[model samples]
Target: MALAKLKEAIGKEGFFLELDLADLKSVKQAAEEFLVTWEKLGEFTSYTCQWCHDSPLDQFTVQGYDLQFGTNTLGRYYFTMLLLPALQRTTGTNMTGKKARVINGSSIGHIDAPIEIPWNVLKAGSEDSKLKG
Candidate 1:
């Protein structure tokens, strides 16, 4: 299976955790589980790719935010904040002798978005407003 291959490729130390960023509850739960499972977190990386244009109109997060903004931005923020304590624990103890980092990957398409994003529209789940912005 693909997962088996991934594990093999990454070696015995690499691990994967299931997370659904679209759901705030899931993000909170995953962060809690990660803290319990891993005493020290060296790096927290999130690679959510929800193209703003490709997002569906009908889909919305439980908090009523636009799916793309909720999943790609808010969810990641919440999850990272939740795991901050664990990350802080690794401050000077990293085996690599480097500071811990949180990386969130964004696409080049983000450059095309309006410089001033309409936060109200996004929070209100207005897909049309998002497109216009």
Candidate 2:
């Protein structure tokens, strides 16, 4: 398994989750798995925010959200909420002796954000060309 191979190579505890943020189920499952596996976390989940230019049929998340927004925004948000308890447990235990910090790093995603709200793309089940959701 990928996790086994990663452990073999680095000898550190990690898990490989088939996480699909658009599918809230996957997000919840990933959180549950993490809670079972680890207790403390300095959380930094980097969700790559982008508006996909789907050249084919438009794609939407399993929960009928724009794939990009659902995964990049909602998915990570939900994941963090699920892990809040663990993060709280580790608060003030870190080397800095301060409370835990949750960092969501948005890397240059704003530049690519649509100039205007493409309502067709934003709404669930709305149709558009090449844009997912």
Leading candidate by lDDT: 1
lDDT of 1: 0.79
Task: Tell me the whole-model lDDT of each prediction, alpha carbons only.
Answer: 0.79, 0.74
Which portions of model 2 show Cα errors greater than 4 Å? 1-11, 53-57, 115-120, 126-133
Candidate 2 on 1-133: residue-level lDDT in tens? 8778888999996766667788889999999998898888876566555554441235567887767777778888999999998999998898988887777776675665568856666446665635534
For model 1, the superposed segments whose C-alpha errors exceed 4 Å read 54-58, 125-133
C-alpha TM-scores of all predictions: 0.81, 0.71
lDDT of model 2 at residue 126? 64
Error of 2 at 4 (Å): 8.0
Candidate 2 weakest lDDT stretch, 10 residues: 50-59
RMSD (Å) of each candidate, 1 decimal: 3.0, 3.8
